[model samples]
Target: MSKALDANNRRWSTLVWGSIPVVLLAGALTVDHIPGTDVRLTVPYAAEGPGPTFDTLGEVDGEPVVDIQGADTEDTGGHLNMTTVSVRTNMTLGQALGRWIATDDTIVPVEQILPPDLGEDEVREFNQQAFVASEASATVAAMHYLDRPTTVVVHDVVEGAASAGILHPADRITAIAGKEVSTPSEVQDAVRAKTPGESIEITVERDNEPHHETVELGENPHEAGQAMLGILMTSEPAGGVTVNYNLNDIGGPSAGMMFSLAVIDKLTPGALTGGTFVAGTGTIDDDGEVGPIGGITHKIRGAEEAGAELFLAPAGNCDAVKRVHTDHMTVAKVDNLPEAVAAMEDFAAGRDVPTC
Candidate 1:
């Protein structure tokens, strides 16, 4: 009996020892944190090319007051490329570990990429809205450069909002309550004057024709006693040159600067890119002011990979730009559209240009 009991005890000890390796291996491989690196995962780059990208503006009503030298030029010059980043979600333990160890990829915290209380759908919708706003801003910047008349229009309708079903995206909000509203604030104020659940007549220009929409005001979720229209808008020329963006599935405002450059290139004579590969990312406004965007380092990688010799970065992003190591790519810090254009010109002319 003593021998049998001793043998059982030895077997128990052996089983406990054998399980240790499996437990350690499991712990090593377990995904304790969401894994994704900012480094290895490069955001896709799109240029003004054959597919969905910047294209030449079609015929408009009035003749050009200012003569555009290369207004009719075809795809002779190289394209101004825009950079984008892919948002990763639900990464596995192994994938996260791989990214963490990878040299090229930088680990991005889960919170930064995915904010709390926000779902993937919400993020996508926000991106889509941003994309629309970028298009409007690009159009405005292009028209502003060309010295043309423009108007502000509704670019998107927020989901689950008052105007979601009533007002469509890209519907030009011409007037509110019989008053001409040119800016987004004006539209907001017009809506604010009315009570929630009240119906107001809004005039919009769709497809170059006047179409009126009667939209009911929704209560502002954040503010009490405030009316909401649940739409996103940007300033656009009332009768300006039409610039069409063919980017499909790619969302976000980071492409605004590139889009504006593409428009300028198509409208003016000579290559805006200076016959060289140019890549950039920034948010462009109607005033031609370039705004900072996220993921500058990743974008630099993308630009470098695309064989871009020159990179146009927003002035606000210079601090971040300084930290990123982009080999053989000269990064120029630009504050506005004019500066970007000048940088390209200087590059083409072989003159000393500003660097970040």
Candidate 2:
């Protein structure tokens, strides 16, 4: 009985000692090195310059469409394959700490760099609401011919906005509080340092006339920050040239040209919406120049699948857009908004409009 018990004890001890290496091997194989299993990869839109790599922020099962309608006043120069995206998700505390250390060493500090090209005060004073307003009112005339000569800027100051109580966009900020505000940082700093719920006077220039507004201060959402006034202000122009256009297609912002053309057509004597679903994607500047936007092929695929009778392709992206287009999909290349609208209107008159 003693000999049998001794043999059983030896077998149990061996089994306990043998499992450590097997567990370690499994962990190593299934750990950080596994592709798709452990780590995921993504392509980001960024300038082709040296910068920190970014991660995905969010994803839409199907892409959202936008209207690229507006005056093409400023020239974006040319389109590039870069993109900017917000990042989401954080790793473990230990991994995050390591990443933070690396970023501190590698990234350029915002404080050390110069302010935006449009200037500091101009940046801080930009209004989101006004931009939407300007987008709605901006329209084109046929004889306008997309005035692409020079860029002009105008800012909109909605009459009922928070800023409307004190100022407008085209009203260049000459000073803030008691200090002369020149840059965006100074304007932001002045506003930020003020006590919550206090009112401060702002000086602005409108049509060469100077005016002052005593704005009631509000709470700043940031930690320990002063009171805030909810307002959007920008140095961007509210109206300008009508350079490029696509006719009669107000599908998405990508179809800005089409929307603009439709606006022009409706505003004018003739009709532009060819009465069919017109789909497209691109940036329409104030000069009416067509600029390339990301995810064109994906957008085209979406439009085609949606059974769009006509697709307006950004002139520069014709080659890429054409590659995926079929006989069922008629890709009409347009330079700007007016042109797109025209194409859509024409296409509709030819084909029976698809029922809702």
lDDT of each: 0.74, 0.46
Encode model 1's per-residue lDDT on 1-356: one tens digit a residue. Answer: 69999999999999999999988756545544424634333222211111122222322234321223413534436647777665454655545565556645556666676566777789778888888788878877877786766676777789999888888888888899999876677888888899999999999888888998898889998999788898988786564545556665778888888877777776667788778888888998877899999888878887787787888999999998999887788899999999999999999888878987
Instruction: Judging by lDDT against the true structure, name the best candidate.
Output: 1
For the record, the alpha-carbon RMSD of candidate 1 to the native fold, in angstroms, is: 9.9
Model 1: lDDT of residue 345? 92
- In order, what is each prediction's RMSD in angstroms? 9.9, 16.4
Q: After superposing candidate 2, which stretches have Cα over 4 Å from the reference?
A: 1-168, 172-255, 345-356
User: Lowest-lDDT window of 10 residues in candidate 2?
Assistant: 50-59
The per-candidate count of clashes, in order, stands at: 14, 57
